[model samples]
Target: MDEHYEKETFLLRIQAINKTFLENHQRAINIIAAMVAIIGFHVYAGFAIAHDFHKALPLFVLMLMTYAGLLYFLLVKQWLKKLEPILQLTADVFSRIWNFTLFDISICKVISVIIILAAFLVWIIIDSANSRIRLRSVGGMAMFLFFAFICSANPSKIKWRPVICAVLLQFIVGVIVLRWPAGNEAFRWFSEQVVTFLNYAMIGTAQTYGFASSPPEICGFSAVFIFSSLQIIIYFGAVVGVLYYLGIIEAILSRIAWLMQYTVGTTAAESLNAAACIFLGQTEAAILIEPALKTMTESEIHAVMAAGFACIAGSLFSAYIAFGACPTYLLSATVMSASVSLAMSKLLYPEIQESRQKDIGSFKFATSKFSVIVSIH
Candidate 1:
């Protein structure tokens, strides 16, 4: 009986070892496959660029350096550990400088005003050199100022820091997208890629309808519009669902939310919702901060609502593209409006009461249940 028990234990141990070895072997195979695929892609790209070697040489070198840096950071732990003390010392020095305040608040405000005015003057000069000033430009500036003055619940309580920063951010983005050639080209390329990607929904639409021929026109518009809209929604919904499951959406929104919270002095919930409004519909964005909604102050609620009204939903990108809207302009407008909406909301309904949820770390994003594929449906 003892011999029989011993034999069973020995067999179990051998099976466990075999299972572990197989798992490790599979991992090794996967790693080798990935490396080979990457190398093959690089080789194909190299062949394609051989004709334009002179032009693509710098890019190739940069790519190599980037890969090298990534590998070094990922694979070399000892080097990172050796540099830890130096990194800590550098951080400490920067922290001390950041915490040091050399001037009084009133004096700092005056200095900031002077710097902003000077920067505005420089921007105007540069912009004038690029293109002639138009009536629309002046009108737009007037409209912004007029709205702020007209909407203020308490003019004295309004915070100008966020308002000024938001306006400056808009102007800077406009300069990049409109004034700079390289930046404009980059945005244009990105916009084209986005439109192309969204166009893929048409494939699913066609497949589902089993269309032998294009549909008849309705009210001078193709009936494809209806099908396209539904298909795009279904397609992008699944894409967003996958992104959410992989934490990509959360990772991106968190950084933007943190930036807004730091720069705009808004509560975590408000900033997060504002950031989310850039990619999601108002209802979906609000759902992200659902837990904090009931406890939110009136100003915070106003900001959230304003963001929803100001921004466009990501799902409708294809619809607008089909209508001949410039994708780059649409994307830029949504991004700029996020900060502007927050500023405008604050101006209209200034927050007098303290917020309960000030830190972004305290708010939890709503997650979908079950598998990602199941949630998409």
Candidate 2:
């Protein structure tokens, strides 16, 4: 009887531990929910102030709302483990097409960016119907037709329920943040001070380790110090520690993944690309999604690589913009790469997919020893 009682106690303890383990992610969920409330209020208030402007360009505002949430969610990459099953289902539908002709990621990167940017540029220059519009109507129609053609080439798995819930949550959060003056200020502070700082650190690391440098115009200040390995090491080390402490790095990327899953089509695991952008840059993003590489249809891989080519991480954004590379060019390039990746992967590897939550967040940052070797030549 004593033994039996002891076993019962042990079982109860195990059950209690399991409950706590599951509850760990609840805090993240609540924070996201609060963010949703904040943003939702903001979006509504924007509409209340000027309904016509909001209605005329709801897509732009919608894009902004998505960006706001993505910026916040990116801070919580670690907690994404709990969100995989759901994310997999949400992202599956957005996978783009696979083009057989594009042989390698390196070249496909250029092709895909050109295609996406060209399309966007054409739309801007041309008018749709020419009602007090200065642009050409034929060009606008051609660009629209081109996107339709591309999307038609690749099919996707549609799971609208999750998409609906996610979008509504995002919109609601926007409104709430907007309605509460205090919340708006807080969110803005987080973006300006927290997010920008984190992104800058990533930029510095990529240049140091990835071997890319900002153009002279962009690197006026950073260019001087970036030349020193010692300085970079210290700067990067500080970035890692501070990011880890504030949890901002994970939060921002996670939100980006969430937004991509909703807007683009892919699995939650696909956010490996975004996560990679933060630290590893583009090819590094591939490593995080390594498991899916074999399973990913060909088109998806191309998009992944192309996104790396098109968009430098947040760190590189300021540099490119400063250099007159065109910020929209970079942003749209990444977006198009992701879009095309899904389509291409589908054509290459056509199989019903399972989720891969295990590979990505288990990232281990192993520090290496650096020994100075100086020889006179």
Candidate 3:
């Protein structure tokens, strides 16, 4: 009887643990939902205020909103720490169930299949709506496939779901940015703000370097003057560091990663790094996922590297703008590159090993590491 009683107690304990784990996971998800609500409110308020008041929102007000958002995100990240153990326990429980063999369908697989179908529907709808189907578009897709196949280290190991998701994502984003009026306007507004702010920083730059350093009137935009704009990269990097420290970037990136993971079966680190690469530089994004870097497979490493080569950082956006690139196009390309980079990497180095989620919290931001190491004799 004592043995039976002990067995009952053990089962009860397991149930209790599982319940707590699920509850904690739900709480974390709720917190993320609240954050999304707040983001929606802010975006709506910005648009409403701008349209109704017929005035651009004060930069200070935007700064305050960003600050508040960052604080909220930081608080949530701390709260998530309390749930990590529960999350791990939940994962452990799920892992134990893998041997049951009762069911074959996995949530990730189901979701990926659904996404594939939805993506196809979207493509068909768009194509049908278009005035004409261009042969060049078909040719371009063939070339992309051919490139992916040739670059793949092991063609047989390629994961089709992620590759398809990546291609569809890139297509959707490209069409929105390059074709949609509303999308163009929104990006244009953002680009204008970025340009205005960067130009404003030129005042401080001129003050520090002296206005006479290279008078554009005389030099006609000398290389020295053009290169001086690189100083803005430092200021932007500092601001980004603060944002990352506050957990705003992680919060936003994680949610994006969640969606991507659901659709493409990407691991948390890959999704987060991909999202982070959109805003931060490749080096910074790599640092953000450094904790998982060592454990990552060749495919994951390739994804990070591809993202870096494909997209420029937010800091460099202003520099590119100064170089006469269309701000909207540059922004569009970087955003699109986030997904394309992943697709390209997955094509070249298909993931043979299953990926596991990793903790994604604030990391040490060390810009000094970006500099080339040299040992002078």
Candidate 4:
């Protein structure tokens, strides 16, 4: 019994390897190899052409080859429109068991891919090669596509606030920059100076880590580089702090609340809190106008959820940008998410009934204390 199990396991492992070998990696490999060959040849041609036309003589041939290959494959050729999606619906349905567990479907797909790789290799070789090949049409693709369509039509729940906020932030920043270019220039310079400072700080950090051997890499403009990294976060924090202190947030909430009651179809208080939530983090934003929650309707609660779903935080932006995100895109997404949160919230709860008024409650100023502690410690 032990020997039989070991033999079976070894057979399965060999089967897995054979499947991987036959599965088409040619599409990817061909593109990569062609790119490397073309680039190397182009670079060599650049240097070699300076002295002799004999070497540069190949340029016409290369151009002809490129154009001819492109024309033949892209425009003139028509060999296979019979290409069908490898993954289709019956297997998906069998895997998903009706969306109770999405991960189960994922597992099914992974397993299916492996099984199909092996199955098709045998099918293809038998159908096409010299020994004995038989080709037959199968009715699998249609069923697979049906399931893929269903999955696409109904995606799993997404926490939308971050997406919304990132978009909105970008739009707001872009408009502000474009509307007053001169003012923006100064702002840009100030930002750059801070970045420059952060750059120097990074240099200091590098020196501490034994990355720098000289002082100049830690001095002057390099400090500005370090400052730039730090300043983006600090500046936004300062702005939010100052705004909260001056009750600008409350005013914005009031206007948003009014808009929701009249045009957008949200309860007055729900819109107010929702708007405030846009400027604040999910939980903290809820506290800005807290008294209304107990009596808040389900739709109102959903609106709040929607708002939370759309907006993003200032705290996460540095980490996001560090990962090579475009700043404009990141900022804009935040702002748009906020807007969509409002729009979507309204969609989920239209304002046809009587509107309710809620008080503009006060939020304690912990922000100032936090800032002070940060500055001091």
Q: After superposition, how far is residue 272 of candidate 3 from its true place, in Å?
A: 1.4
* Best candidate according to TM-score: 1
TM-score of each: 0.74, 0.37, 0.65, 0.35
Best by lDDT: 1
Please, what is the whole-model Cα lDDT of each candidate in the order they appear?
Answer: 0.80, 0.51, 0.75, 0.53
Steric clash pairs (candidate 1): none
- Model 3: residues with Cα > 4 Å off, grouped in runs: 1-55, 58-133, 212-214, 219-227, 354-377
Ranking by TM-score: 1, 3, 2, 4
Name the better of 1 and 4 by lDDT.
1
Tens digit of per-residue lDDT, candidate 2, span 233-266 = 4454445445544555555556567665655445
Q: What TM value does model 4 have?
A: 0.35
Error of 4 at 277 (Å): 3.7
Q: What's the CA error at residue 329 for candidate 3, in Å?
A: 0.9
1-377: candidate 4 lDDT, tens digit per residue? 99999999999999988778657676777888999998997787777776675646556455676688678678665333232233355557655653343644455544544675576566556646664422332234334333433443222432233223323343345556645677466445544443343344345555553433223553352334333445444555556666666666665667665654443344466656556654565665676556666656665676677777677565445545566874545544554456556644443343333434443333221233444423444
Ranking by lDDT: 1, 3, 4, 2
Candidate 2 stretches with Cα past 4 Å from truth are: 1-248, 272-280, 290-299, 325-377
